[model samples]
Target chain A: MEQTSILETRHLTREFKGFVAVDDVNLKIRRGTIHALIGPNGAGKSTFFNLLTSFLKPTRGEIFYNGQNITNMPPAKVAHLGMIRSFQISAVFPHLSVLENVRVALQQRLGTSFHFWRSTRSLDKLNDEAMHLLEEVGLEHFSRVLTVELPYGRKRALEIATTLAMNPQLMLLDEPTQGMGHEDVARVTELIRKVSENRTILMVEHNLSVVSNLSDTITVLQRGTILAEGDYATVSANPAVLEAYMGSSAHD
Target chain B: MSINRILFWFTLAVLALTAPFMVYPVFLMKALCFALFAAAFNLLLGYAGLLSFGHAAFLGTAAYLTGYTVKDWGLTPELGILLGTVAAGALGFVFGALAIRRQGIYFAMITLALSQMIFFLAVQMPFTGGEDGLQAVPRGYLFGFIDLNDNLSMYYFVLTIFVLGVGLIYRTVHSPFGQVLTAIKENEPRAISLGYQVDRYKLLAFVLSAALAGLAGATKTLVLQLASLSDVHWHMSGEVVLMTLLGGMGTQAGPLVGAVLVVGLQNYLADLGSWVTIITGGIFVTCVLLFRRGIVGELRALWKRSF
Candidate 1:
């Protein structure tokens, strides 16, 4: 195989008080592939995403990004190195206009984020580029609207647009289609597929249809452990995966 | 700027230029000083979403330092103000570093605790004149040519500094730095995930707000020729908060309007003595209950709805 891993975890483990949220689990994500992690509510998918993004520190484990140890790196530094994550909740600068939301991500690269004396007009140069990103997500029509007023689905699109502005090497989307209507789920699923063309995407998705539609590889986690790892068909057909989702009766 | 904004600023500039003739220049100067102070506080609370209950530390520190430098060291008024502002900025740097590690109510409590420490230091420091403070500090010449001793000259001087301070704030609020601050306020985790060091931005905002508050304090000391214990009291910090809350926390003009209303009320209600506090509290209650966005915030919202 010509594929190389873009991210790797070495026995990643996180324990909460006495309960292990993410048990010792080693996982690898191939470069430029859409990999989905699916698990029930208590299966620790959120905790795994948090640990991967450095939002939560693992009790014991190391994270390697692009083959370099990033276990101790800060979340912002992790993001700066081209690994950005989206929230389980829709995250957009609520009061800012949709266009301003994308412009801010682009503005960070100019090294003037700390220049207090300069007028915001300096950011006007990014307007065209921001609009281009918005257009990509089909949010150009809502550019001038405040993000807080956006519909749930549109807000998710705006989140992706901002993530796209970062041009990340790896995008970790935590439940990108969570709580969306069927229409929104499909729209966002397609959007993810489009954005994943040049970037490796590691998403935690409960929507099995979205996973089956977009994931090149699928990993099933059950109670902080990997229950199955393979392509959609192989993982779905696995008895353990079936029992985890259903009950032991299904396997019997 | 929009037509209405230009017109509004033009009106404000004209009123400020001519107000000393109609109203007492001293009273106007006092209001301007407090307005600047409130605006500075708003920068932290409103924009950065960090409620600092100890902002009076910055204000009072600058006032005392400016008073001492101008009175004892024989420094020029500008240099005195500069020293005071720089000292406050340094203090802000320290406070910000310590407090930025906390969030919400904990952050507010830490600032209040730190400021109480300063209040005690003010009481004990020999240079501070204790409760007597530094009184009768001369308003030295502007560049040794224009005498600030003249009330008219002093009024213009205070006015000029107030304008410059507010202008700097306006620029900051509309700048890239301000944008990041707003983002941090709106969502800290998202900002961090977007590769922004949110704590660093919060610290810088804290320092800028402290320095600006110091500038207001130094100017107030010059206008009144006194730096007293009242400046550093926790009450003063609470009053600044009231001013910002009354005006509107995040809006550009909210704190300014709040400061004027507050200072003006205190002046007119001086005959009531201790009752003034009660009346002020009543007004605050009313503002919060009826128009929680503050006067300017409500007005902006109304305008947005209407137009």
Candidate 2:
């Protein structure tokens, strides 16, 4: 298959108060595939994700999203370019109903958000699209329920639903299944797999089993640098990968 | 569309319209004016989570403009009111931009400092008549022929303006823009991530609130035929805050109920002199400590449970 890179970083680096949080990292995410970035605590995976999504401006280097340099663009503008990100913790309007939450994102895409006088009900197509997105995320039944009232796992799902409302070409999921029960983790992992069919998905996963089970390619990071990158079978068996996971073992 | 909520608001509006017949028209008019003031304040405090301490600038500025124009310039009441409202909105645009640069307590402090500066300016300005204010300002014809010198006619006119202002606020809150304001209040960062220009929304809300407060203050000046230092003082700002807090911080009807109660207390206790201040202060403390949800908020909460 021809390699079509959806997102690429050229020697990306970020420094905070004299300490390098993300150091000289190079990454390439192929179009239409699930790529997982896995590492131990303090390995800077989250910082790397932040840099990619333009939440934090990179100290050095360039980010090319679909061949456009978006090094220091604001997150909202970056999101408008078919890239959307979901937080490790659920980020949503708790006071808004599930449907309203999705509708806001849908509104952003439709360019009808600033029409203050027209009743929001007039945007029937947008509402239907929002409901469809909710349905896809299995939240259609809880459409009118306030987001704060939703179950923890369901809220996480709703976050994805909201993100999906933007119709992003590339979806960034930071620990998409974190802090979930075994059942929820499985359900979310399955959902992520289903979502990955059309859009390229780059996610940070702590659970090796989930990564091995879902990721087509895995990149291992340790101390702000990529330790190993390949298919799960090859990287998981690499001595460096094993040492990075175990610590000081591969050094000996 | 809920029957109870609809009936409740309908009944309240009817009572507000009719209360002047039973109670002193002047006192009812005062309450109506303050109700508009409190509602405007609540637009910022309740929806945007911005606690302004200089709202009196808008009120007093409008009052003075309305008073000076009607008294000295010989403008009609409606034209004078328009001039006042426009001035308030213009002031809000400038002050809101400056105040919104800082958030939380800093924003409140900035507004307070600006308003205090305006108050001192008003005290020295010759047009405001210093401490004496611009008294004996003609009420002028409401449209052209309807005389406003009659106390009952004046009360109804004030009530009509108050109702219009409140209705405007209600429409604003139910609008989609209002939802975005709530979203910003709940979590500004999240709203930004979702592509909202939060600061712009906040500034607009501030301007709208200021204009409405000006409308109230201008109406009050017409009612009393004076625009004095009391309208622009820091105490007036604090009073609005108290009204909003006493009624319910974010609830719509809270400010109205809070304003009416405060206004009525002041009218009944005017003969008690300095005790009015102490009593109002005591009520403020009690409301903050015990009845923090205010009358309408408490009622809504109760109604929600029953349903």
Task: Please report the candidate that would top TM-score against the real structure.
Answer: 1
After superposition, the stretches of candidate 1 with alpha carbons farther than 4 Å from their true spots are A1-3, A247-252, B1-5
Candidate 1 on B219-264: residue-level lDDT in tens?
A: 9999999999999999999999999999998998999999999999
Question: Considering only chain B, what TM-score does candidate 1 achieve?
Answer: 0.98
lDDT of 2 by residue, A1-252 (tens): 225998899999888899887888888999999999988888899999988877788989999998888897887688778888888888788998999888777776556455445455655567788889998989999999999999889998998898887788998889987888888888888889888889999999887778988898899888888889999999978998787777532210
DockQ comparisons of all candidates to the true complex: 0.91, 0.43
In angstroms, the error of model 2 at B150 is 1.9
Q: What TM-score does candidate 2 reach? A: 0.92
Candidate 1 iRMSD in angstroms: 0.5
Q: Tell me the whole-model lDDT of each prediction, alpha carbons only.
A: 0.94, 0.87
In model 1, how large is the Cα lDDT of residue B204?
97
For model 1, state the Cα shift of residue A23 in Å. Answer: 0.4
lDDT by residue for model 2 (B1-307), tens: 6999999989987886788788888888888899999999999999889999999999999999999999889899999999999999999999999999799899999999999999999999889999998899999898788899998889888988987898888877766777777778877766766767777889989999999999999999998888999999999999999898888878878999899999989988999999999999998898788766887888888899999
Which number leads on DockQ? 1
Cα RMSD to the true fold for all candidates:
2.1, 3.1
- Please state the interface RMSD for every predicted structure, separated by commas: 0.5, 2.1
